[model samples]
Target: MTSAPARTERSRTDGPAEPHRRRRMALALAAGGLVLGVGAIVTLAVWNDSEFATGTFGAGSFDLQGSTDGAAFTSDAAAPGKTLTFTLDADTLAPDDVVYAPFAVQLSDTSTNEAAVTIENVIGGTIGDDLTYSLFIEDDFGATCSAATPPAGAEVVADRAADATGTVDVFDLTAAGEPVSLCFVVTAGAIGQGEAGTITWEFAGTSGDTLP
Candidate 1:
């Protein structure tokens, strides 16, 4: 009797099993890796755009006055006839930088009378040699009146010896009704990284026939 027909060998392709689950797992892993890489790049970009630090610098001002007309006469010094006050503010400034402030005075008057004025720098004290300043004068018509050197025994004060910071007071008399204007030039020394702040100036003076 003939043996039962030989059974056909099962072929790998003929089976119901497939690589679908493995392929799906691989695709999911690749997509996850791409998302992680993009997230890391975005995080780095944001971190680089932020500022580590910041600061600001500025100056304080005072009102100018005159004795005679109050409206006609003006002195570079504060409230002409009163003690002038100057305050320096060095806030948030880099420790290495220097600051400087320059000042100029103008006098004007409508009357024919001539006026005389003087400016002084009073910081630490007179005897201690702690004060310093330069003087410049101009007439009502903006004409140069005279130039003078630093007063005897006067010291030029500065935040740093190499770079100085201070004020200039201008004193002068006007004719009678003319107008006068004063200008101040301010400067800061080589700023170091991270230094920031403001400088304040306080001036008080009296407007009279003569300077005190």
Candidate 2:
């Protein structure tokens, strides 16, 4: 009876300790999750603060200057029906009397493109019938028509066959004052003339995208 009396009920506190431990573990997990969420929110705010700022993008001229016998043309305006008239100024134009009339066509540096030059629609005067003329172009390129050497190029622009057109290679102008020369060596014909002869004609310069 004495041995059995010592067996008292020991209340096991260890059983309840497990639930407290689980509660502590759950609280630690929740604390860790909260910390991660706060860190993620901070990272998101920092990333969202970055921003990016707002962003922003003509023709050339083709002009020409023309002259006759070293004198500038009356008007540089070029169009249909426009003409340059060269009149015989000598008191008497005898046979073999050669007159060298130096003419020039200038292209300004402001012109962005090369021009195609042409002479057309030559209407001769009554005196022109009795006279014959030869046209020559200087090979030496410059602005001045006054060249020291005689023009050697034998190109006939006017003769018994009066109506003839002449053309130059599409070329760029030297400068504003500089020009290519077109020399007319007009000679009196063997046939005698009645009145003062005249040569009335026009020249045209056109520029476009066409290439040589």
Best by TM-score: 2
Error of 1 at 80 (Å): 16
**Can you write out model 1's per-residue Cα lDDT over 90-152, one digit (the tens) per residue?**
333333322222233333332333344433332231211221223222232212211122122
> How does candidate 2 fare on TM-score?
0.49
Count of backbone collisions in candidate 1: 40
- List residue ranges in candidate 1 displaced over 4 A: 1-169, 210-212
Sliding window of 10 residues with minimal summed lDDT for model 2: 140-149
Off by over 4 Å in 2: 1-59, 68-75, 78-91, 139-149, 153-160, 163-177, 208-212
RMSD of each: 23.5, 8.3
Question: Across residues 2-112, which tens digit of lDDT does each residue of candidate 2 receive?
Answer: 455566664796568878999999999999999999988674334345678765304655667766544453345644333333344443677666555666677664666
Our model 2 lands, by Cα RMSD against the true structure, at: 8.3
Return the lDDT, model 1, position 152: 27
